[model samples]
Target chain A: MSRLGRVLLGSLIPIVVLVIYAFATRSGLDPYYPSMASISSRFSELWLFERVGSDVWPSMRNLAFGYLVAIAVGVPVGLLLGMVVWLHDLLAPLIDFARSVPAIIFIPPLILVLGIGDVSKVLIIALGAGFPLLITTIDGVRKTDRALLDVARAIRLSRRRTIWNIVLPGAAPSIMGGAQTGLQVGFFLLIASEMVGASSGIGYLMMRAQASFDSPTLWAGIVLLSLMGFVLNLLFLAVRNRIIHWHLAMRAVSGSR
Target chain B: MSRAMRKSILGVAGVVLSLVLWQYLTVGGPLAQTPGLPTASGTFERAVKQAGDPELWSALATTLVVTLAALLIASLLGIGVGLLMGYSKIFSTALDPLVQFLRPVPPVALLPVALLVMGPTSNLAILMAVVTAMWPALVQTLVGVRGVDNVTLDAARAMVLPPLLIQTRIVLLSALPHIATGIRIAASYALLMAIATGILTGAPGLGRSILFAQQAGDSALVFALAVYAGILGLAISQAFSRIEGRLTRDYGPTAEAAAS
Candidate 1:
């Protein structure tokens, strides 16, 4: 079958299942299984008025701020650690130990120190996201091609110049991979942070819906979250492809061979 | 001093320095004005006391149990789905978009739906964990199975081997390394989800303990529990890596690279 035909065939499964579910629950046969119509209607309601300003925007703001902080801190620190062997060795155990701690575990103490505020949420997200990026960036910088480094040195490049022009470009692919992973971590933690102690955000909305037994609202929040995640992931991929065109070309060449 | 010894000394110094800084900040530094914040020594003492508490141990056990249950379910489902997709081109092509769409949806976001459907119970926690943790394993398995040599399958078919036998012996072995990597990633996600559920739903686990301690103004105990959580995370990841190493010793270094 053609690719499109196969995709349509695969899509039929979910569509059929949903249709059957909507039919079964249309008469409120099951309170737990909200009808597709109810959910779709709730989606419209949320999109039109309730959720956008209060939940979605706050959540996206927190996610973006936290993710940017992680990248800003993680990359430079990672580069320094990777370049300075002794510094890396000195902090390796501590970093490993701290990294192992789930970001959720820090939420309580963070709340205590920073209060139940945006600062705590943002910091928690940053901490959760930072470690992955840091580790990956360190590895990337450390693994910069020896030949490239040699050429840089032979050309009498200064330390800063070598790092900016040679080291970063060489390590762009791995660093980008780390950033992608960090974004996912940050996104997950953003929800957890909002759920724990916040007054607004998608997570807070979902929690409230669950607490009130508002199945339609609950389903709407979930659908919205899924859509947000899908869009953010696509956006990240688009940016990654644009920024790392050289890396993609290299991969294609190697893959073909 | 030898390089290894020097490194160890530096590592220890780093730890000690951080502890001292933490102690100063809580006990004597400018931030000491923050009420209920524990000093380093106080946290250590409370941690020692809490080590003997049955409640702490029970909470730890509950968290571990939930995590293990989720890991097992996710593995079974992921591997099963992955293998089916790998074996059939049409199935893979059809499901590709669905997989991509669902993969990015944060598993924790499903907590509300799970709670609404299953209520605040271990079942809900497991559901959340499985939803979040299964993707990596499924994706990896699909890749591994697709990468299996067609020539090997053709030879097995030439021998008139049963389809089931060929799938079990040939496809499974070829995919084992990738599956191991997936399981390792899933295991971490499972643990994360377990704690998350505990914290969010007031479930009986380390996450709940941390939440309760913080609420009760027992910052020391809360810090101690956080340390325990860290140790548990480290131990679980380390154990999985060791197993992965043993299983994929002959698969070359690609498995290791992929893991990191």
Candidate 2:
């Protein structure tokens, strides 16, 4: 009963806020807030698979391509750096410097050089998303247990076997964390880049809406994007759980202790 | 050479190698004729010139103001809300769902809305920044508060400390390291948001400077300004980490030590 009460109480804020917004914007009292009804209508009208092909797919295609590139480059490079002590040390400063730079800053320079094209968009997303994966991979590899390494050596495991059977699995959790962060960062870059210069994409749609004072359409875009973000996070969590199910179990056990 | 010395030397060598490659690419290499790709030395020259420009410094100041203001707001709000959530189970249940709902919303998704409402001003940046920047502080503080040792709480209670005193002294102190971490993360987020605000909304800052440069076809200046942004970001992040490191060392076990 208390749990249900708490949930009801928790939901009250959103419901109250929505009701208030609907009432206030009933006849457009607030210039900025389009009425909730109009927003919902617009949300369905514009975003319900209507703009999916031209806008949504292009954004998703770039995001997927770029994210994959980041993973492909980041993981192996991270592993190589993690295993090679000298190389890691040598690259530490450069890596640190790059990580400090917000991934979005690269978009302007890239677009300037590569034009406001898909190539530039994909490249920028890849660059933005790669750093988290790279950093986490290095951290994960560094934190792998020495005892495990010794056991692998004692068992006369080949280098390939050692990495495949031991190091990769151990680093899976960290790499997954990186993958999740990378995806979020990639998503941000995509939207930001699209807002700035894209001819097509959800960001462009929202930007156009904002420019023209199409408040309802803009609200619709916001709802759609937020849902998409939440869905992407949920999808990634599922993937991460699959990759590091044991790690999650271990964490749960240790936390209780 | 010592390991540290060797590493430093290698690091410098790596930087030098990159510069050489950059210089060669636009000045003497196949990409020399590429439009908007400035020679390394040309970019460096512009960067130096920018150091003497009052306008650039003013723009830097504007960016700094927006970033710091947003960070302060984010830190206060996140920690404040997080404390209430962490302290009361009822409050936690009430707010966690909303926070989770909001958290996954990529903050930039709200930028257009914020920009529309606030009209491309610093307020829009700060408001949107707080939306994104507060999570680290909130999550860390909640975790920190929840993870406080029962034994320590009991000891504080034995001393007959008043409720407020117990909270202020025992609870907040224990959570300082985590709060410091959140603040550190929040700082970077603030900077990112501030720059984004300038770039997207045409608010005044280094981001606007880059945008202006891009528009004017001053590729060299754009690259130069971008480097300045990198330096600013690097410097601020390093400063925050150092401060957080010291705080964690004094108050509690650092994450690395705890992990071990």
Candidate 3:
């Protein structure tokens, strides 16, 4: 099949399935539809908007905060391990074991200690985000060409300058890859954390919707969460492409298109 | 052996030091008032106490059964689908888009639908686990099969070897590393999804127990369960990785042999 034909077929299947589902069930969903026109007529209608915004903001804030914190902590730890041969040798097995464990495993303990509040949720997301970022950044830095380092040395560049100029640039691609993975995992943990306990957040909204058997609203939250992840991935890719222009991976892309 | 013992002692020492620091920081800090937010000593006590509980052991058994069943089913289906696609271009082409489309849909998003269809059984947990875990195995198997040298395949064909023999001897062996990678990914996904499905269903397992503890505001039990779950997750990952390594060493095609 042609590329366009394949793409259309790929998309068409899901749509067709949904249509079959809608017709076969014919379940009434009229009540679930948002009534934007009922502005001053119903206080309940206004509460929905407030509920959505409030729930969404706290969750988004936790996600962003956790992501930023993970990146900050992970990058430095990764760089230090990558640079220090002895430390790398000693800690590689322990780090590998730590990374292998699912981050959600921390959520229960985190909530136990931090309470069913924003702090535990944020920390849970941070824990989820940290591992991938650290591993990928370490791999990226370690993969930096020895020849490039020699060149820096040959030019009599200061050690710090060489690290800044050569190491960071070389590792940018890998770090970005790690960041992409971390962000997705962070979102996943966010949902799990919110669902378990929390007064606010998209996850809490999902749990609430589930409890109420509000299918449309539940689907809406799920869709939004996936969309957020997809968008973050795109943004990461765009930034990576721009910042890592010197990398061979980026150069290979132009020829393909 | 003595060096290993020393290292273990040092590890224990590090844990103790960290616990001491944690206790000091939280004893009179802002976190002191939080329910279930236990100090280091508190958690240690809970862990010690819970270690002797029959209910905890039974819940752990339930969790293990669900996780193992899911992992087995996922591996079987994934490897089958992946091998079929890897060996046939037409099959790969047909399935590629479906795989890509389904890959990014978060497993948790499918919980409600699973609940509706299956209505809370071990089978429901199994179904959720399979869907979530299958993609990685399939993708990895396909990649591994594709990585095998065409020259080797051609040589085998030229020698009039039967297709079955060639696949068994060459393709399967060459694909071991890729399959291993897939297994590692699938194992972790299966573990997580099992717990997720269990929690969602209020089923008999560590997940359900954790939720029960949460509702009762039993912070110590909750933390103990989380610790056990973490240990379970770590054990599964480690065990599979070791198996993967062994298989890769035994079956993965060597670069020197390929070059020759």
Candidate 4:
């Protein structure tokens, strides 16, 4: 299809769904199904500028802190473990057992132990989000090509230089993939922790709306979240393309996986 | 020692060492004074005791049932939709935007909608799981369908194979490894969402048990249930991953385009 054709075709579903929803909800038959007009108005009222500081900022900040911490700790440790076979082997069992437990399980105990503070929320997000990056980084580093290492060694490349040039670049695609998942998981945990035990943030806002049967505001929260998700993904793709344009070009040449 | 032997020894030592550390911290170490946290031995013993209780077993059954039911529905619906979307470029182009728009929205976001609309039932959990867990399978199958070799399809057509037969024998087979990856990930998502629903909505499951244990101030039981839930997740994910590994191996990684 032509570029214009693709855009028009892609836009078709959302437009149709919106039109149908708009007409159906305006009938006012079901209270649970809020009208699009009201929902959008509520969306603007709740998130446009008012709650952006109080609710949205807190969630985003928590997600940022947690995600940054996870990456900072996870990447170096993962790289080291991946490089050191003995250390990885020694920790494999423990790591596997721990990772198997979904990170959400910690919300209750963490909240109970540490109280419903930002510290608990941040820790919950960090612990939950860290696993994907950690696991993928370790695996990615381990998958670094032996032939590349051999050539580097034959050339007597310094250890530091070899890692900077050969190892890191080769592992970049995997780490990049891990980073995307890490952020997605981080967002999931962020909302979940807030929902579980939070007094502020978008999750709290939506939960309160539900408790009070405020469908329009609740629906608005969903819209805000979906928008957040869309933007976050776009940003991730931008970073990914910038970093791994080479890998992507290779894929484009070879065709889709 | 042989490499494999040494590795196994290290693995065992790692597990034992962690458990010892856990025991030390909760039993008499620095963290021993931490209130409501159970000793490693206490948690393990509680797990054993919980196993004997029929109520706990019922809770396990509830969670597994929800997870399995969701997995089945999600797999079937996802593959069906993915097939349609993949088979028709027009359909895929029309729907891709809507799908992509929602991709990053986590399943937890649906908690409010489901609670009001569906009530805090196991069905609500199933609904969440289906919505969330089905994505990986659907997305992968869409990719898989697109990745089917054109020449192979043409060759099959030349042999006078029906379109249905071609899709089944050639396209589906070629895409089986990718589907396996999807299903494995889907299993993890399904279980996670199910337990999460329980935890958040007070639905009946190990998650609710944890909530109740905490409320009752049974820290040891809470810790034990969390441990048990971890084991359950580990077992389910390991089983699926092993299957995925076998399928990918049997299909040969070098075959077609490899799944990312």
The TM-score of predicted model 2 comes to 0.95
* DockQ for all candidate structures vs. native: 0.65, 0.68, 0.28, 0.70
What DockQ does candidate 4 have relative to the true complex? 0.70
Model 1 CA deviation exceeding 4 Å by range: B147-174, B253-260
Chain A TM-score vs. truth, each candidate: 0.95, 0.95, 0.83, 0.96
**Candidate 1 lDDT, B70-121, residue by residue in tens:** 9999999998899889888777776777898889888887788788777778
lDDT of 3 by residue, A1-257 (tens): 78887666566656787667556545454444322222123324323466657876677889899999999999999998888765665566556556755566567667666778888887888888998899988998999999999999999999899889989888888898688778878877887787776777766766676667665655565456555666666676677677776775655764321
- Report chain B TM per candidate: 0.86, 0.92, 0.88, 0.90
Q: Which is better, 1 or 4, measured by DockQ? A: 4
RMSD of each: 3.2, 2.4, 5.1, 2.5
Candidate 3 residue runs with Cα over 4 Å from true position: A27-52, A85-101, A112-117, A140-157, A165-174, A243-257, B1-13, B26-35, B116-121, B150-168, B198-201, B253-260
Clashing pairs in 1: none
lDDT of 4 by residue, B145-236 (tens): 88887777889999999888998888888788888888988998898888888878787777788778767878888888888888989999
- Per-residue lDDT of B65 in model 1: 91
Ranking by DockQ: 4, 2, 1, 3
Model 4: which residue pairs collide?
none
